[model samples]
Target: MTELLANHVCGRWQAGTGPGSVLRDPVRGSALVRVDATGLDLPAAFDYARETGGAALRALSYAQRAKLLADAAGVLQAGRDAYYAISTANSGTVKSDTAVDVDGAIYTLGQYARWGAALGDARHLADGEAVALARDGVFQSRHIQVPARGVALFINAFNFPAWGLWEKAAPALLSGVPVIVKPATATAWLTQRMVRDVVEAGIVPPGALSVICGSAAGLMDQLQPWDMVSFTGSAETAAAIRGHAAVARHAVRSNIEADSINSALLLPGHGPDSEAVRLLAREVAREMTVKSGQKCTAIRRVFVPGALYDAVAQAIGAQLAEVAVGDPRSEGVRMGSLVSREQYDSVQKGLAGLMAHTDVLHDGRRRALVDADPAVAACARPVLLGTRSPDAASLVHDMEVFGPVATLMPYRDLAHGLALARRGQGSLVASLYGEDPAALAAAAADLAASHGRVHVVTPEVGRTHTGHGNVMPQSQHGGPGRAGGGSELGGLRALDFYHRKAAVQASPAVLQALVPA
Candidate 1:
């Protein structure tokens, strides 16, 4: 009986042209909605964004654009209940987890608004008195950042639909560029709802916010030189787009946020008796359970000192086992279903491959329900792998089993742990669990080249730990090498990408005349 939503192309809701695909509840194998792009007018959508939406956004000043984004956030905040009811069918997430995707979006909007205010009126390049080139006193110079001449295209991932869309959307709108959002097929319904609310609120220009629910066919073919493209998903997909022939020919700027084998290191001093050790285990388990470990930033590896490997593994295993798994709607279920049976199988296959390289320390293998059908939802327990291989990089570093699966490796010292952590080529984040400031600093600096972000965890940060699976609005959430070399949501850095920069120089008299006095 649940009604599914469609894409918001141009100024209104639309249906696709091809045979539609059906979206199923992850907790229950029931049809949530049917989605398709068979009839979508891609050319018309692009034109509308360029001519209508892009015009209006560009017409407004930076502050004006931010006000529109803030208003859009207000609308989303008011309709969060609808989002929760719809999101419940996707996976098992606590209220806080949903907040990270839903409410966090509003916060991101606010952050972008603040960024606009900080940019000041003239976009000041350098502050100083003007130098006199001649006795007539005519020459001068100054720098400014301006908006690009086209729209921004955002292709989002499935896990945190609301957060992903808003994170990219907030910056684009704030930068005075309209946006075209293509939500991942798995969770397009949630994005549809939010976009619909945004449109109805009339916070932005009619053509400024375009949406496509299905295939992105013909979408890239019509891009202009001034436009920018951004994508978030697996490394394989990101690489494909970055290497797309059109992208290269058009010299289009592409930003990709890809999945990485993120890791966490537990220092040697943290024993089973240490509260820090228990806290680390708890944090690791929480990361696995939240969003059913569907996050691109999820901790796929755990590094522990050799002396505490057994204790760390056992503690983490027991905690992961105790996690309640079932329908996200059910009262006690702490972990939810995989995005789909396809993803569930992928997780299993990845785990099976990992088991070949490492020992299975804990197997939370069991069927979790999908809806009320009991056996329909595709679900699996978090798989824990412990490796004794002398070369951790060759065995564990190359193989990344995405899902709730994580491989725990042993190291002799802080230096050894740092070396092991870097074995994964590169990661989006690396978290260290220890109270030792010296050790944390040394290891973090050594591994800094491999990770984009690193968090040092202690009891003081326990309450607001954001977990290893979560990415904040202010952090750079992408990795290098295998993880994909693109970043998303690093405060103002996210906004500036939409606009192209060029330094203009001329004689003082000429520049003064160009500048509107």
Candidate 2:
């Protein structure tokens, strides 16, 4: 029997009771651990965080809380190697992928910490200068932001255990609110270990940060009005969470980042010979293989000019063919397996659904593996499908396979391409590749309305441009419609999600007392 991972609740580690769900290694198909929360007290966990953890964090000034966050980042950064090892076994991610999650989490925490300096020592943040409410200016009105008096519940996705936990926890903790993290059961071990490190380091107060592994059953029932819930998963699950009795009745605040069928477009002037076409082809392939295309921000749709359709498709297909799929630890393996057998089946089903309307341009499904057995590991080769009649292919725009797969479509004109891109309803990101600066700018400006972020890929910036799938702390990371209508991680704006804003009307003397000197 493998080790049964423990849950961190109320400042202690407790072993779970009864038979638990088994977690397997994606690359080797071996049982890695068992996760359960049978005996844990969900209500008590919530109360402890609110009463104990929330109190502790609230007592500290903004600067003090920020310093603690910086300290926690240092501890996690020192343990990066151990996290990479765990990610390879559980998430089946290559070295680069692990860095993106682990290193990115650490960097985000540090950025938040440094950003705290601008917040000052004030416990309450003033929204703006005072406004005169009376003729004599004796009575003034001012708006202020304060940390919520309740705890934050973070329901994370399995695709990014480390990054997901840190990103949500950092903002909540910085804003003086306690956090209760419920990592996706399939990959909870890495998150569990991270919480353990932070706890042992003693950088955060007891109950400030907690983790619940296994099932999320009864967790939402414990939420209060002041409590906030941040979730990242499928749009279907997000809808279910929104409809939960506790959420709907008590009006518990919730933020969601759900399914996104992100798209990448190549402008008309960029043909096969243009550097812009090459850059776009490379970016699409990179998004497909990285994290096995499990990212919500990954490009699922590629739009190209009708004249350059075959040229772009063949270029991307050739790039996809060179990608090696096998065990993440194997030498020269660039792409790894899906997170589990269930995910493998899901991707195959999605591919079959896509094949219904689109023709296969590149089929790597039958390709030979490097060091692992395709039958034993949860591996699926990258597949690319194409459709000339994108308007007729409803499934291509609506479905998100969530694996190493993408669909290519040709548009008659820029207007047609924009229409096809908007068919995703809304997306986390969209990329426009072209040499003509004016054309790229115009397309990006138009796409901005439907996307949270837009990338303009040109030869000059191609060398330094962060790829489409990468999410930085300084940019908003949410979208509208199918992508979930919530925004987060736009620098200090992320703090707004954790804090409540209100208007304060009082005498000028009282106003001065309310704001820090």
- For each candidate, give its TM-score against the true structure: 0.92, 0.98
Error of 2 at 93 (Å): 1.1
Candidate 2 accuracy as lDDT: 0.91
Tens digit of lDDT per residue, candidate 2, span 239-320? 9999997789999999999999999999897658789888988999999999988898999999998999899999999999
**Model 1 compared with the native: what TM-score?**
0.92
Model 2, residue pairs in steric clash: none
Q: What's the lDDT of the predicted structure labeled candidate 1?
A: 0.76
> Residue 494, candidate 2: how far off, in angstroms?
0.3
Clash count, one per candidate: 15, 0
Worst window of 10 by summed lDDT in candidate 2:
116-125
